[model samples]
Target: MSAPFQDKVCLITGAGSGIGRATAVKMASLGASLSLCDINYDNLSATAKQCASTPRHLDDVDVGSKQEVEKFIKDTIGKLGGIEFVFNCAGVNPTSIPLEETSDEYWDRLMNANLRGVFNITRGVIPHLKRGASIVNVSSISGIRGSAQQAVYCTTKFGLIGFSKCMALELGPKGIRTNVVAPGYIDTPTNAGIVKGGEAVTRMINGNALGRLGTPEEVADVVAFLFGEESRYMNGAVLEIDGGIKMSSTTSSGK
Candidate 1:
């Protein structure tokens, strides 16, 4: 009966699946008006249907394209009136390979999808964000620590952290707070290959202090908190929802 996000307008990228889908559903349930986008139309439609009763507008978009991102922002603002919260969850998980073996094209693809996507969206939305707006960017634990054969992936995520921190500094004075969420070993479709990779995955799961993978919903809960008034004092902070993977040394979850 109580909706914390009532009257709030939220913009979420990558709303087709994983943490992004979960967050969209969460915010909708909390009474937020939503503007969602993802490259996958079918999946994005499914997400929208789940919250069909809520006020929402969605489109298929590639966040890596600056022109596409700008258009999405314009359309979202035009429909929703304005944005109060933003969740940047559009990204790609790369194939693991040595830096030497990683081709220039592949590296650029990863950077563009994982890093530039966030950049494009953030830049497009700054002028439209209302005072006291909140932004949560999805980073990976790889951004905090290195991993094997994930040179390009790590590079993009690490770059995301720096950019988000800078957003916090630049936007905080405007009363818009920006924060980052670094999730480790989440059981999302993006990590389906690693999740089913037999013993390697088992050992990885055991390494987390919780000895389990986190769910998209679990991470969504933290994201909702970050956007809510409860975390008003929190700014430029990175919250890890990795089931203690960051603290455990025995597990190499390939986050």
Candidate 2:
């Protein structure tokens, strides 16, 4: 059987690490050509080098900048002929702080990186997207429900979901599909130090039906599916990959 993504051009933001890095490698392994971007030039170069395909290009882009995102999208179309898949995965989660203590800088940083960044990139790529193309926005389970000290982060994730749904409705008739993958607490180097053994980690694990934190690769798998024809019927969908964490019945209120 032929590879699912053969000859397709995939554009991925945050391709330096975490879910973005995993998705890039996974798509490339399935025969897709890649255009990777991240603020970390060194890590982006590392990802480009690990790809199975030759002639891959890596760009250091601030996805929050409309001009930068538009330029990257145009350049990718110029080099690769067209864009078929877009994985909007750039995001940030600041150290947990109470809502009252969260500074203006903190809120702006999270909103710019997590929400506006997705908007910038997606809008730039919209006109260039090929018929039947797909876009997957990386959201979070926090978007679906509240979490202590995660107000700002959750706001961005929720905004992303709303954006994805609206885009899907607008683009669906034009043959472009848009959806979101909301992953729960996933294990990644970025969070390695912060998620160290603690009551918080224990609470997170026990809250999930699976009793485990998810893996980046697990989230990547759902992303890959959304990019493939197998999920062509799915649009405007917020597919949750949280190991049933959102469905847990436990409540802080003692019954």
Candidate 3:
């Protein structure tokens, strides 16, 4: 058979790094036509370089801004045609701090990027989504459980789950599928410092059933599956790609 994504139009936000970049590369290899955006143009250009030969449009977009998202979506449809897949992978990670120490600035930052950004992109793309389109949102294992020093971050993620579920119900009759992926302790640019620390690494491995941190590519594969025909019947599903961290007693202390 031809590649599963052959000729399909896939839109990925946060495509500058981490899981988003990984997914873009994977989808490109599978023959997807892509529209990729990130707030960082240099990083985004690097990602685009690695996905050479695929039909793609690149734009520097801050998904948190409705205007930026709307413009990018308009440009994408004008360039790549209608969207068949969306990966809402843009978000900010939390800093370890007591709730009292969590500044208003910090709260707003995470809320804007993690929650509101998803809202902007999803809402803007709905009108352009082709029938049977699929959307996979990236949340965190912290979303499903409580974590110390991450109250606001957890709140945004938890809120994201509720929002995605509601969208699934609202868009189901339209033949669109919406889902979430909650990953735990991923090895990404955002967590590079943490993973480099001996104590933090040990804590993360201990909490994970796989005994190691997950890779961005691993999460990307699951996102790709959710967008593929294989997951046709799945909707409103929140899959945990956390190395079984949720089932373990030990948990990362957000250090």
| Highest lDDT against the true fold, candidate | 3
Displacement of residue 121 (Cα, Å) in model 3 is: 0.3
Q: Residue 215 lDDT in model 3? A: 85
Runs in model 2 lying further than 4 Å from the true structure: 52-54, 192-197, 246-255
**lDDT per residue as tens, model 2, 1-255:** 357888889999999988888988888888898998999999888888779454466789999899888888888988888888999998885466789999999999989999999999888988888689999998877677766777888788888999999999999999999999987767776652234557656665776789877888888889999999999899999988877774552211100
- TM-score of every model? 0.95, 0.92, 0.95
Candidates in descending lDDT order: 3, 1, 2
* Residue 85 in model 2: lDDT: 92
Alpha-carbon lDDT of model 1:
0.86
Give a tens-digit lDDT track for model 1, residues 53-157: 988889999998988998998998888899999999988875778788989899888788789899999999999987889999988888888877887888888
Which pairs in model 2 have colliding backbones? none
The true-structure Cα RMSD of candidate 3 reads 2.1
Model 3 lDDT, residue 158, Cα? 93
Residue ranges of candidate 1 with Cα displaced over 4 Å: 192-196, 246-255
TM-score of 1: 0.95
**Model 3 off-target regions past 4 Å?**
192-196, 246-255
